[model samples]
Target: MELEAKGICFRYMSKTAPILNNVDFTLKEGDKLALVGPSGCGKSTLAKILAGYIRPSGGTVLLDGKPLPDQGYSPVQMIYQHPELAVNPRWKMSKIAHECWTPNDELLKDMGIEKEWMSRWPTELSGGELQRFCVVRALGPETRFLICDEITTMLDVITQAQLWQTILDIAEKNKLGMIVVTHNNYLADKVCDRVIKLTDINHI
Candidate 1:
């Protein structure tokens, strides 16, 4: 199975230059791909498009030769850079964690989430703590592909390693395809099997 972007093209406005132009790629199941590029080069935009969060001006994102599901739980899940922006401020951590499906104790423990933290609001937890919830939330059983848009770039080294290990382990066990989008070439090289520069694919 593969998550493929076919002839992808996009722009925020008609007058503005295209953010992405004729981009394409395929990430097979269980394979990790690093999408590396300079800032404002549309890596994150492409990530969102591949995850079905944004509609492309031209072309389509296909998962195993079919379009991504429009309703219900998406097999393609995206974890953003800022955990705080991803969660509902009014919701508690427990609710956010269980928004998709209730994560088992083992999974929570592996993600380094303490039991008590679930009861607190999003504001109560630190960035790293909240990010743990975001990652776990995206790991619902229905998810087959993950769009990691610099998910660990803001964390301390130790926290980044721990969170990434947990994510890598789970992805490996489930054979999930992952698109790791980032500007950090070193981190991308360390985590992904294949590295693609956005400039190489995006004509814009």
Candidate 2:
């Protein structure tokens, strides 16, 4: 499978300048691509478009030459930089984690998710701990592409390394396509097979 973004354009408001213009890229199974650019360069905006979080003003995001599904579980899943904002505050960690699918024990272990934490609320966990759940939740078997938008930016080096290792292992095992958006060049080099600069593709 392949995820392709073609001629994508986006703007926050009609009166404001476009944030992304004519951005394009493709990611296929087993393909790990890093998107790098300065902050506010629309790297995150493009990632959202690809993940079906927002509609592009003037283009298409296709999965395997067809439009992404509008209903049911999307083959594309995105893990955000802030896990707290992504989950529901009213639910426990177990409910949030199982909202999509019940991740196996082995997967949870690899992600360093404690079984005890599952009974607690999001507010009870540290940022690093919350992020582990976010990562595992996005790795369901149906996910064919994963968009990671600076997902480990708030963590320490040790936690970041552990999370990345688990993510890479899971992606490889599932043959999932990955788009990693970040400003960290070292991280891009370490995790991606190829890199695309947002400025190079976005004309805004």
Candidate 3:
């Protein structure tokens, strides 16, 4: 999926401060972009806007060169810091995985999650395990772009490395475009093809 944001600006009604100011960028298929900024610098907000979750107070977000469309082909997906929150507790692991089902039944197993774990509840899984599923679910067919918002922040360094490798492999294998939202400069440099500093935009 191709994405473009031009002169985007936004501010919360609850606060007088503006979060994003005249931000602009683009992500083409298989392009990996890292958004870096200090806390409260609008990284997550911009990610949400790009994912079509929040409407910008000004400017526009276009997906595939067209204005935002409702119920589109699930062209974009998000992997949040906490995967369990993204997964439903009442739903079985299989149901959660079904949200973005793939023909490769061995993918999760290859990620070190056993096939039997698919039957367990998300709450029963470890943080790292749940995160692997989150990547799996988002990378499944029908998803073309991913907004990864500090997805590995909660995992241990080892787990973070493993998960990052998995996500990178999947993105490369599928030629998926990705927007990596994070404050971790190291991870950003390691994962993204280009880095955009939102704090600099805030000053412009």
Candidate 4:
């Protein structure tokens, strides 16, 4: 499988300048790509566009040479930087975690998710804990591609390492295409098979 972004472009308003301009990239199955750029360079926007979270002002995202589906569970899934913003505050962790597909207990344990925390509310967990749930939620069986937008930037070093390890392991097992968006060059180099700078791809 291949995920392709062709001539991608995005802007806030018609009158405003485009943040991404005619950007293009492709991630083949089992490929891990690191999207590196400074803040406000449209890395997050491109990630959203790729995962169908938002439409680009121009261009298209293709999965296996066809446009991404407009409905149903998208093969492309994204995990955001802030897990708190991604979940429902009122739902229990179990519901939120299983919102898409149920992750096995072994997978949950690998992600450092404790069973007791399943009954708690989003407000009851720390950012790292919440993020673990978010990651597991996005890793549903149908997910073939993953767009991670600074998902670990807020966590401590140990937590970051642990989460990345689990994610990478799963991706390897599933042969999933992945895009890791971040500003940290070292982390990108460490985790991704290839890295691209957003500024280099975005003409705007």
Per-structure clash totals for the candidates = 0, 0, 0, 0
Q: Estimate the TM-score for candidate 4.
A: 0.98
Candidate 4: clashing pairs of residues = none
Model-by-model lDDT, in order? Answer: 0.92, 0.93, 0.83, 0.93
TM-score of 2: 0.98
User: Best-fitting candidate, measured by TM-score?
Assistant: 2
Q: Name the candidate, 3 or 4, with the larger lDDT value.
A: 4
Which regions of candidate 4 fall more than 4 Å away from where they truly are? none
Question: lDDT by residue for model 1 over 1-204, one digit each (tens)?
Answer: 789999999999999999999998999999899988788899889998998999999999998899999999999999999999999999988899999998999999999999999889999999989999999999998889999999998899999999999999999999999999887777888889999989998886
Residue pairs with colliding backbones in model 1 are: none
| Candidate 4 lDDT tens digits, 158-200 | 9999999999999999999999998888899999999998889
lDDT of 3 by residue, 1-204 (tens): 688998898887846877788888888999999988888778889988888888888888888778776774468888888887888889887777777666376677666667788899988998878888778787767777899999988888987887788778888988889999988889989999899888776644
* TM-score of candidate 3 against the unseen true structure: 0.91
Instruction: Give TM per candidate.
Output: 0.98, 0.98, 0.91, 0.98
Following a full C-alpha superposition, what root-mean-square deviation does model 1 have from the true structure?
A: 0.8
